[model samples]
Target: MASVDLATSYAALILADDGIEITADKILALTEAASVEVEPIWASLLAKALEGKDVKELLSNIGSGGGGAPAAAASAAGGAAAAAAEAPKEEEKKKEEEKEESDEDMGFGLFD
Candidate 1:
């Protein structure tokens, strides 16, 4: 079985909703069939859904397995992708810092 990344699956659903009516059961089944962890993706989707009026109720509905509006889900997926991209920058920065420390320990500077 081909494995689907949860984020990608959620994003796909968000896009699909643009042309068709998406239901909670369909979303749940997609996530489950993907054979990957989807809790984080679901949480992100829920956050987007709650951005409107009655956050508590909105979130409660989402938590109870209700599908969010297409636009909201798409927005959430975009946000998650942006956030995921930042993670690489952080890792790169950490690596650079470690390299600089190692160089310093060796008494080597760019000028040296």
Candidate 2:
């Protein structure tokens, strides 16, 4: 079952590598020529997803966590990091409030 999926994927990649347009028919033909039986739907889905997209650029961006332009992604990541840093401060405030509630439950406040 997995082999069939992999075969279709490989066929699409091969077409992309060779600078050929990937399509459902081409994928199906490649898989058939390689003696690997793959479902038609898989090929169609892969082809649809890759249509009008740069395969090489997509491959190069595999290591990047973001999908847009590199500079935009970098700025977004920086903003995310800043937000993450501020998150701990909010969590600390929550913890302090919880501790105060627990202390009141014990019939004592810090000053008393």
Q: Point to the candidate with the largest lDDT.
A: 2
Off by over 4 Å in 2: 66-112
Instruction: Give the range where candidate 1 is weakest over 10 consecutive residues by summed lDDT.
Output: 50-59
TM for candidate 2 is 0.59
TM-score of each: 0.31, 0.59
Clashing pairs in 1: none
Off by over 4 Å in 1: 1-76
Candidate No. with top TM-score: 2
Error of 1 at 106 (Å): 0.6
Candidate 1 lDDT over 87-106, as tens digits, reads 87899999999999999999
